[model samples]
Target: MRHARPLPTYLVQRYHGWKATAYHENKAWYRRLAKEGQHPRAMVISCCDSRVHVTSIFGADQGEFFIHRNIANLVPPHKPDGDLHGTSAALEYAVNVLKVAHIVVMGHSNCGGVKGCYDMCSGHAPELEEQASYVGRWMDLLRPGYERTAEIADPAERTRAMERQAVLVSLENLMTFPFVREAVEGEVMTLHGLWNDIGEGDLECYDPAKGDFVRV
Candidate 1:
């Protein structure tokens, strides 16, 4: 711990500014949140990409949303093998413990995780094909999406398709959990898929009936 470097001056200054402004402005709300444990109505699973600001996009206040972020915002199929499953653990807590009425898997444009999967699957990144590549292995969950999008002739369009695929895949995998299935079937919980176009500041929601993402 002693070897850890001191916080950067710029980050420290920014934190102080935020603490003085936003923290001061919402002092009473913050205290209330601290006294009463969070009871968020929704849980959002989103990408770790720096550009994707889930709270900012949704204008969410503190403790309004219980969020979990990982590369590509993926959710693996339910596997009760007692292994280390960070996403699954978050899902379990959100659905069972928090009892959030809604679960949203939100993906974004130009995601590095999705791009890396495309490169590896398209033979553009041979190094990623190695056994030791953690990213490559994690992205294997998106391979089915890649396969479905590979036939597209337009590179840009294919990438967009893959991005949406990430959302669809997560939605499908979410149902693999028995609790999730029960909640959804009993109308106790609802699942949603969303994609954000960072550049254009556009949002899209998946329409299961049309099997495509519709701009919102």
Candidate 2:
């Protein structure tokens, strides 16, 4: 508590500006939203990368999407081992409570977390290999992805493939949850995988028919 301080001056100023303009203009909408509660259509699991703006990319308004962000946008395989699980909690809430129709796992280009997984799996990142490194342990989920892309000779292309695998792996892992699986099996829910090219502003979606990501 002693380390806590007031928000930064720039952020305070920006908040005030927003409050005076956007908030002022949308006061009724905000109040209605507060009263009605959220009923988002989809749950989006995306990277912690600052550049990957999920709401902006989808043109989503406030309360339109239930977003859960984590390193590499990963969803670990279901393990009800009586431990803390933030992403799983969110998924449970989104599916059981909110009952979102779609769950989208979105991966993006130049993801540092995916690159770290690649390096760690390749034995190039000793720090991540340590037992105490949280990131390394979490990224172990992507080891299968690294193995899938290891044969590619081009480093850049291999990294790109690894990034896509993040989305694919997460999509696969999502089905491990009984509730999610039941929902999908019952045709009430659908799973999607997306990859974004940040610089080019391009998006690709997984096409089950072709078994590859197609431009969107």
Candidate 3:
């Protein structure tokens, strides 16, 4: 069976997504919804991967969960975004404007973005041409975790360790935003850290019980 050149998964998913929209009477739905208003209950910080879809995984509909997606599903501390911060902007909207009740930072297994972090840590990206201006420097944020786990000799175990640390770091970054801090302090919002193991088709929630992620 021949497939399209390069087989871009997003292209296929987009075609099917459009076809599935036949049942959606989307004629001016956004305009009508604008009149109705929106108040989503959850805000999901997720990866920009074609396979990791929070809406589908959570079985949510439009206006159900507001979403923010970026490379690695990362949350950087609230710095004056002199650059476009799609995730931070969306987070501000959800936590401040929409006042969502829950914020879920979802990291996933076998993530290429997380792999990039690993590759960088391995000292494999020595060429300056490999990064955009200051991106290489900013990527240093991940160094602490990688160095702490350097004693773990097994490659697979090291990767998993790094990925989990990324989730925890991102969860902590959420608190850097004042709105998020206020919401949590006022009991208006709760934070959750989740890991989606694509290989096992399982969702793991961070459990304080064992101080690690547990299937939920």
lDDT of 2 by residue, 139-207 (tens): 998999999987898877898999999999999999999999999999999999999999999999999
Q: What is the lDDT of residue 80 in candidate 3?
A: 71
CA lDDT of each candidate?
0.94, 0.94, 0.79
What's every prediction's RMSD, in angstroms?
1.3, 0.9, 5.3
Q: After superposition, how far is residue 96 of candidate 3 from its true place, in Å?
A: 0.9
The clash numbers for all candidates, in the given order, read 0, 0, 0
Every model's TM-score: 0.96, 0.98, 0.81
For this target, which candidate reaches the highest TM-score against the unseen true structure? 2
Clashing pairs in 1: none
Off by over 4 Å in 2: 82-84
Ranking by lDDT: 2, 1, 3
Q: Cα RMSD for candidate 3?
A: 5.3
Question: After best superposition, candidate 1 residue 70: deviation in angstroms?
Answer: 0.7
- Worst 10-residue stretch by lDDT in candidate 1? 75-84
Best of the two (2, 3) by TM-score: 2
